[model samples]
Target: MLIGTVGNEPYQRVSSDNGPYEGAMLGAAIGAGGAGAGIFGARMHYKGIDNRAKRHISAIESREPVIQRKINKVNEQAENPRMSFIQKAKSKIADSGINQINNLRTAQLDSLNSKNEQLRNVVDSMQHTNPNVANEADLSRRSHYAQSYADINSHYDDVIQGSRFSKMKQQVDQSMEHKQARIEKNRDVKVSRLNKELEKLSDGRHKWGEDGVKLMKQKHPYAHVKGIGRSAAAIGAGALIGGGAGMILGGLTDEVNKHVKQ
Candidate 1:
């Protein structure tokens, strides 16, 4: 009984003494483990952040030259005049065609006026002759003059109202309309291209800006991660490891106490 008591007393003392020591050791181990895990997680998070930054930087750099070129092109077009050489030539041609029509009309009118003048002179010369003969000559001359004038006027009107002239005018007007349309189309195309280039520049920057946080959330790992820092994951992993270690230590401590009591 004395031997049994001695052994039991030492066992109790050992259990008691070991309890706090084991607790402290387990706590320290858990803390160390957690700290290590947290640091590792923080490093991983930092790596991811750096990688994302590089991706954005690379994309921005790659597109900068293209954007500059587009900007230069747009500026060049803006600095230049609206009318092209072809457009000027078309305008000149149209003016020349109009002038030609006018000249043609003037020439026909002049020819008719000269004929009328000659008839008038003949009628005036006949007035000095015998009265009866002068009267007859004057009447005939006047009739012929009137008839010639009427014929010339009729011919001029017919020529003016001809389908050929109408067709030519129509063709010129249609050509002008087509040319105008082409010029407008070209202008619109240039404007549209410029707008697209501007849009690309704006959108690319937007993807790399603070607004890109929302876009990042849509990605894989970024979506799973709640915070932006590398330390968050590390801290979470450390907490889990520490908690498990603490639980294991508590269980071992409980078993030791039970054994001592028994």
Candidate 2:
């Protein structure tokens, strides 16, 4: 029977029960198995296992608020950038992809603005001075600094707002990078489930392969599914003839033992 699926695809598993209860029991069993696998022989092993996984999951859920707070801080930092003359820069890059990167760019713009303003102030001072040589070398250097700053800022703007698709392409690439690990993990889970199913099918085939020797060995193994199969056969036989207390006793004993074991 098909067990179920996880992730994006539907996967099937082999089992005797095809009913909904099978799934319910399987869920409990997996929970129990995960728990009991750790301690090995603990009582109510399955129950403990089921509970253990739940507890672990609960613990993780409890950390969600703490994680959200940290993410909020990062978001705020990205949203706000501080710099002298950066007010205009921030306004210019308002709708850019990432707030943090935009803030850094705004800061650079602020730096350029400050340099140009300082250069202009210097030039004004020189014109006011008596002798024109207030410092010709310093004035030339300041002029070069302002020109270069303007050029850099213009080039950066060109790269950022050049094309509509550029921002979308960057967003897609970043999304893929973030989801890559989860995709791989989901793939692994699918493959592992398939492998387990294949192994079980192979074991069943080998156990019942023809020539009848392996089949005989399994049928009469040291411990076998003694009650149900035997009783089923006997009942089928008895309905034809009319009576069989021995078959019923064997079946009842088998059922009692199975219940006690469970």
Candidate 3:
């Protein structure tokens, strides 16, 4: 029969066949076994949580240097000039060439207009039997000349719009912008991830409290003392209960045997 409780909870039982001393010993053994199982389970639970926290911390430490190096490299690239002096000079030369070509096209158009005017004057001074033919020929020449003038001007406008230096400047600016954006994105992402990991591991709790092993000890204090204390208390209680129940049972059994004999 179960004889006693630890903390108001029954934990030990004794067999009916056992003598008083034997019953007491069996009850005590059962109590101790139960306490031991409880202690083991508690220890494992605490250890699992602590180990998970430690693994997370270790992972963060190992990855920090690699992440920092990548951050530095990106920062350096963002800060440095994209174009060298040679490249700048080349862009300038290309821009100058474009300007020269635009000027040449303007001069050629002016020359064509002047030559056309002179030919028109010569045609007007000559006598023509068909005046309408002459008029139609002059109109056709004027149309062709206007078309040529418009085409040259359009080409010049295109060249000016696509200036090499301007294009290069825009490209360099865009490249720098992209690099800076990348640096910021990388830093934010890594820092946010690390912070979240630390938060989870620390259970949203930490402080700049101690250093080295002391820090670790503070964070995860030993449970040995508490466990030992509980085990000792349990054993002591079991032994006390077992001894009292054993004496009572022994007296009752003797009384029952004597009654049976009579």
Candidate 4:
């Protein structure tokens, strides 16, 4: 009877504890596994995000040189050259009183030349119609007109010769100056935009990197701690139950020996 009780007692002890022990171990394993996985995944994800941020920062930095190259190209294209002699003279002679008088005289001379034939025909008709007035008037009018035309033509020739190259050079130089100014203005705006974009990328990269570091600090160690705590608790409880079972088995063995001895 003692041997049978001992055998049945050991069976009942195992049957009673088996489910709870297995349950505790399973729960601990799942908890620890989940925590470990969470820690690992979080770390990996943080690394991925960090790498992407770094790449973004690098890409932004790379564009700085490209922008600089564009600026350099524009500067090269728009470089100022020294003024030519004609350009200098044009700058000196512009809008002066002498130049205005010369322009007006040249215009009058051109108009007089256009109407010369008609004026000569009217003078000849008048000489036929009124001989006395024509005889006196014709000599003075022709003499005065010819002398004035000659003097004005000579002055216009001088003015044109002095100003022709100057005018053309001034036009060409002004065009270059205007184009350079436009390019410089556009370059300034482009550089400003690039700088803003680069700053934005830098700021974004820094923020993301800092956040990743903080998240790693928060998640990785915490996950490990949780996993270790749960696992340790399960292991300790299993040990305690096993020790109690050993004590019970020892007592049952002693009783069985006593019954055999009797």
Residue range 22-121, candidate 1, lDDT tens digits: 5444554556566666565655764575467568767877777776676566556555534556555665665565566657666876886787678667
List pairs with backbone clashes in candidate 3: none
Task: State candidate 3's TM-score.
Answer: 0.35
On TM-score, the stronger of 1 and 2 is 1
TM-score list, all predictions: 0.30, 0.23, 0.35, 0.35
The stretch of ten residues in a row with the least summed lDDT in candidate 1 is: 2-11
Evaluated at residue 162, the lDDT of candidate 3 is: 78
For candidate 1, the TM-score is 0.30
Kindly give the stretch of ten consecutive residues in candidate 4 with the minimal lDDT sum. Answer: 15-24
Residue 261 of model 4 has an lDDT of: 79
- All models: lDDT? 0.59, 0.47, 0.60, 0.62
The regions of model 2 sitting more than 4 angstroms off are: 1-164, 211-262
**Tens-digit per-residue lDDT, 130-224, candidate 3:** 67777877887788888888888887777666776557656655765786777677766766666565555444234222233345544543354
Which segments of candidate 1 are over 4 A away from where they belong?
A: 1-103, 109-161, 168-197, 206-262
Highest lDDT: give the candidate number.
4
lDDT assessment of candidate 1:
0.59
Answer with 3 or 4, whichever has the higher lDDT.
4
